[model samples]
Target: MSEAAFETEPVPDRERFEDASHVLHGPAGSAAWRQVLYALYVVALLSGLYGFTVTRAVVERYGQSWRAAGAVLPVAAGGAVLVVVLLVLAHLAGRRRGPVTPDPAWVDLVVASSVDRWLTLRESWLLPGLTLLVAGGLLGGVGGAALVGGGATGPVALPVGLGGGLLVGGALALSWLSGQVRADPSGPSRRGIGASLGSALRMRTALRGLGVDGLRAHSLRAARIGGATFTADTRSLRLEVAAPVSRGRRWRLHPGGRVRTLLRRDLLGLRRQPLLPVGGALLVLPGALAAGWVVAGDAPALVAVLGVFGLQLGAGLVAEGLRQHGDALGAPRLLGGSVRGQALAHSGAPALLLLLLGAPVAAVSAGALAGPVAAGAAVIAVLGIGAVVLAGLWLAAFRGQPPMGAFGPNGGPTTLLLWWAWPRVLSVAVGALVLVRLARLGAGEAGIGSVVLVALLLGVLLPVADSALTRAAAAHRG
Candidate 1:
């Protein structure tokens, strides 16, 4: 089933990509078995958790530690049952492996086609989206249940469930749609292993200048026909196939004329970043203010919120400066460079300064603090915070390797903790200052030099100390 001639022709028709995606193409029996196993596994796992919790709590409440085994008899039995069910599942999956049952060749062909179709993601969008919708609905239900469990009226908000479902569902649907759009029209046909081998050999000749002595790519399924994979070779070279997915000129959309640059990238990836990784992150100005309200309360919360906005302004500046600085340094060698661009490049210092100045402006507006009195203090605090960020980045950049490995002899989790913890520590310090300031200023409180003076002293002290030590260390080495 070689696809050589199949691809040249256009498709005569396609059931809307959605129909193709959602519909089943596999043989009925295996499909049915997968459905049953999935359902059983999910039920067994969740029920197991509930049963364990109930039985344990009952045993503990009875005030008999040794005799509690008898009290949790039901839990023990349930656990045993779950183990048996899991074993049965493992056996079935094992059976799905090795040997083609009905005419080895036919079995091979069926398995190969099914596996390849999924791997390549060349199918209809509707199928995947429906699958995701059902999955998202179940997940949302669980989340809503938890929210309700916390004594809130979670069940009353149907919109939350529906919105969660659509957001997750629409995303999956769009992903499926994209696959369909990219899928080669003559996708179903197969090709010879010998030709695959030849292609591998040619690629080797081009890249490594080595003849392809042998190549092996584990297909993960014994396909009878219509799909194949070319894998492993002695050439360890990564062979990265890079190409531009986007192109643009930097332009700020912010009021300050600062282009967001590559801030969000594309529409799809608008909010896709692992910034804080685990959890507990604030997005932008609004989020910053909301978080302040929660943690700092009214008046000071307003100031804290403003301070966070300043941090964002600073971070954005640093980020933009890094980009332009790299460009100006002739990185990637894009040239016929502009003098105007260099003169007014996005610089980190300015962003940091704006944030520093803005924080006091935001807080002093309450008239609790005298504005003209504390200008120096606000500038000082900004400088200290900025220095912390710059120093942290510089250290990490210098280290330039994972915590623990051959190159990083002082590596491992310990190194990671020491090296990467700086940014977080700085954030905490800044957050604490804002939080404390708010507590001191209640709506009734008023002051001019008090807060401002403190900030100025810290600002001047930290940077001067940092520069002095850095210079000393360099001089000593030289």
Candidate 2:
């Protein structure tokens, strides 16, 4: 080869470095970043307009002396302090184990190579850091605005917000620092020493004094020498570790029949892997109940809104249960039956469970004023909501390929606009109407006919629609 040709050739090291950098940081980083920026812009613009109007409305209602708005500050401050303390302690405890271990590829390719560790690792921390900073800033801004609007303090409000943001930001930074310190290979010996000393501190006495012997046992450990490093005992560390658990027991049933076979397997799967179902219920049910209770006194219409929302939450759990089976769509083909019949068989357990769970909550939420008959109607309506939710989720799952654009693998705002979300929204609107009718029934303005009508529409009509939709979707796919 000519000298000129050799001179023009690209360096192998530079080429390899570029390839490694792209893999570490993600090839689509620029596009993803742009999308995030656009999303933020849209959110900011919408929030600014909505917040301005809301602020103006609040000001007009209570003037600058809106002290009621500040009533929750003391409570909020206490909660914030408690949360921050818990986070810090949890973070510290996490550090005892060491920072998150990198992926096998990242360890083998990036760390073992001559490349800078910071460059490869920065991508992991950058997104989290930005998220924390934004969250802190937004929380501080909101709290400050509320305080100022309520006339809690004039000049102090802005400072308070800034301070709050800084406090949160600092906490996050400390957590990141702890992780980095743990990850540093050279610091393990020093960290182990610190752990040993910290383990011996008067904190144990304080924990005993506070009557948290369990915590004391978990937090502190006797020192042990493992090679050159002195570290806390592993027994105490093991005490702090938690294992995942299921929410319910598996049902034992004769598996001779096809339906029974399908149900038995599904029930077992759901009971054994109940985390998602239980977690979704726990996360959503309390908020729904709280909202229902708040509006229970106003009128049934408001309570009905809660009912709809509550059902939606419950529906999500049912859907999760169905998903656990892994045979929702294929059961028809495997078992040789009509799609609709198989779908119904698959959905039976979830629907029954939903009804069982929703009945009491619905009755209580209707209040004593609802009387027995109206209360019965409300309970039935709630069950209907569950059925609808189950049906909707079934259709969404088997009706076609799960939506791909927004909610598919990369979840985003588009997920909220899915066919699944639409049913919840529609349920709320329908609930308002049904609740208004129930309110009239209780007051003697409407007859028993209204009660029966609502029940029929919800209990019978909705499930049929759901079954039909599921069958149609299945047929289309076939």
Candidate 3:
């Protein structure tokens, strides 16, 4: 055919593209089926082991406690909270890496071509959707089994759990797809739960309407992010995920003392990124409540660990100043302050914010769990834990790139992950240990002297640890 005639010819349909893609990418053969079977086998094995070994014991212990306390309302409330959180998380994740994101090369070749997106990209959507559906059903079935075993519900709970979980998982998947659609700059402007659901139902049409330019850009960005993840380059991954500052530009910092100036700088940065502090508070509030419950001896040791993790994450969000300083540690002292002094200054805003946001919640939770008398102690414990966690974040922030040895033959991905996570692990471990010990001591009616001794020991250790980490961070920069 002549060049002009070929150019004017009608474009191939989605089916043609789909066939071409499958041929190009190679058809799934016996090896693929084998891998799928192996994965299913492993999952079944693990599920059986857990169901036989751990589920019964855990159900017996917590199920009785829950039933004794008339926990129907509490369980429902917790489930609601969990659902909201998961949905929100799913939306955020979709924005970052959507369910329909195929490889960038695939986008450049197949997706960018004149083909119906719904037909072309439907596989990507289907895989995640089916996975979520199955996983949710499994989880729900497990929960139902636990409830039945615990005598909290009848045998009818099994089907109900399975159905409920499937519905929830589908909802989550829809929310995720909605986030991806919303992230498209040229897409619809309407937003909210209704809009989200509508968009999810119409996702195929939505994808079709989305500009290839936007998809290509997002695909490229996602590709870069995936590369960073594969290489375990957290710094690059963080940079990739961080949105540019677009708010609070009108606000200016006034002249003040060095420490005050630094604190103000941190606050102003937070103002620009209002979500950071808001998200931090959201996490911190719940974490503090959990911590208070643990301290009041109303929750298990595992709760303390979870609480510590939440607090650590929350604190990390607000400690961007520390991270920035750590990133620039090797650079010249632009602020003309000592490293330790600057580190301390960077911590001030997070400390104040944590105390203001977390303390009241902790106090109230403690009061409710163990009477008003424990409220004051809970407040104290939160402050202490916050301080320790803040220091740990500093340590983590300053932990420069992993050493070369971490990726050596003897050391592997696990070692590298451990190296990167050591500071957070240590911090969580220490905080949980402290909270668990205090809970035990209170339950045992320990003497005031013992409490004071523990307090004094922590006081001495925290600063030393912080200082050491600060110096180490500086040295790494050097």
Candidate 4:
């Protein structure tokens, strides 16, 4: 699509929110809950701001020392303060003088009867860990390497290995537990972390639904909705409705032309920062080429391996970009629904970048410029598709979406992973599968590898990407 056309895709804010599929509320809801919740929310806000301001001042004044630690103290304190705020908000939003929203996935908490419950953990915990783990691991590796080089040994490898093992083991346990619980017929209809999360989500959804009706789980005040306007002093969420709308139903495509346009104009705004993946691939090139050389002497194999590394790097960048996109797109809704767009936008840059990275590398290795160029182009095509699927995951990042924690979420070491990071995983998995299978095909080297690589991009990555984006876009409303 042309840039102007793509950029001008007409979508508006109110329309966007109205078109939102599964609106959700929190547990402990009602009219009274809103007053108390908003108060606590304010408190959390103040605490967070104070913590950030103080932390910044300390960091500016003191070189990364006790001052740094001191900075963390307030943020942590503020976070706790906010937790209290959110809990209260949940209660208060429920208590609003009308029927609160309801989550759709009230089926069984295991798989998320609705998307709201699924996404809570992702927002609360999953995204942070996903963003942090690789960085932390890279740091750990750097630290381990540095310590070893500087003459520290006994304590180093042991922790790395043991810690890594524990992390892996914990993930396995949780995953196994999930399967086991889900398999059990009568064991808490919802299974594993999903069940508990589903319960929480159900509470939010139920709250909104009930809140709209002017009743709360515990509060004395009642709320009522009339036409598009709520009662005075109700302070309920302003929900826009089209004609034919009724109680307990979702908002649809009507929010007026101007609002719809504004929403699109705001979120899809082309303003951007330099994409990180371009730099990432360049950075990883040297190491990847070296690794590729060692892995296989075959020219095609080497090129293919390079493609994998490119995918990995691209995936990571795309993941980060998507996150930032969410930060931007979500500002208006606050519900975090536009994360899907973020994913789409973020992934788009990296997919292009993968082509940039792959084309030259593939051409150089193919013994001929044409071969390398073709290989690189193929690599881009494949990863491009993968990027599309990756966008599905961005939807998964929102407040009510599913928590696809990378390693699973028990607060164990493994919890520090992004389960929603499918693009990265898909890229890696596709690269490996193609490389391994093609390596065996053996046209002595280059030809077989090229064919295999192309196959993967065409057969695996592209299709999956299309499928993922479709699902994510459709469900993002939830």
C-alpha RMSD in Å of predicted model 1 compared with the true structure: 17.9
- 1-478 in candidate 1: lDDT tens per residue? 4597787754422332233334434333225336655875686467446743444353344325324323236334644453444333322222222111122332244323323322212212223445555655655544444444433344654457556655654444333332222221322224233332333233222112111110001112223221211221101111111111233234323322323332222211212322211111122232233222323233323335455544543444334333333223323323233322332233333343335443444334322333333333333334444444443333322222232342344544455455545544554455445344433344324366546744664575445434533443344345
lDDT ranking, best first: 3, 2, 4, 1
- Show pairs that collide, candidate 3: none
Per-residue C-alpha lDDT of model 2 across residues 1-478, encoded as one tens digit per residue: 9999999986665456568767766775435456655765676565456654565455445443324424245336645654665455435544443222334455566545655544444443444455556656655665566557655557687678867875786466446435334323443346652442333233222112211222122223211112112122222223333223334444555565666666666556556656435644542453234233322334323345655555555555545434433234443366566555555666765665555555565556555434566556555545445555665555444433334454444653356345435545655666555555555543456677877766765676466556645664555558
lDDT of 3 by residue, 221-331 (tens): 788897786566876787777777878889999859889999999999999988788878877877887887876775756678888888888888888888788777777
Show where candidate 2 strays beyond 4 Å. Answer: 1-42, 51-116, 143-261, 287-295, 299-307, 321-337, 365-378, 402-420, 439-464, 467-477
lDDT of 3 at 309: 82
TM-score: the better of candidates 3 and 4: 3
The candidate maximizing TM-score is 3
Alpha-carbon local distance difference test for all models = 0.35, 0.49, 0.74, 0.38
Candidate 4 C-alpha lDDT tens digits along 1-478 = 9999998997654443333332333333224435644655565465345643553353344324323334336434644553444333333332232121222232223122233433322222232222233333433344344334333344565368346534533333233223322333344444455563343344333222221112121112212243112212111213221111123233233333443443433223222312233345553353233223223333333344445655455445434434444333424544234444444445554444444654344334332323433444333334433443343333333223334452244542343234334445655555554544433322244465566565656575555555554554455534
TM-score of each: 0.37, 0.56, 0.87, 0.32
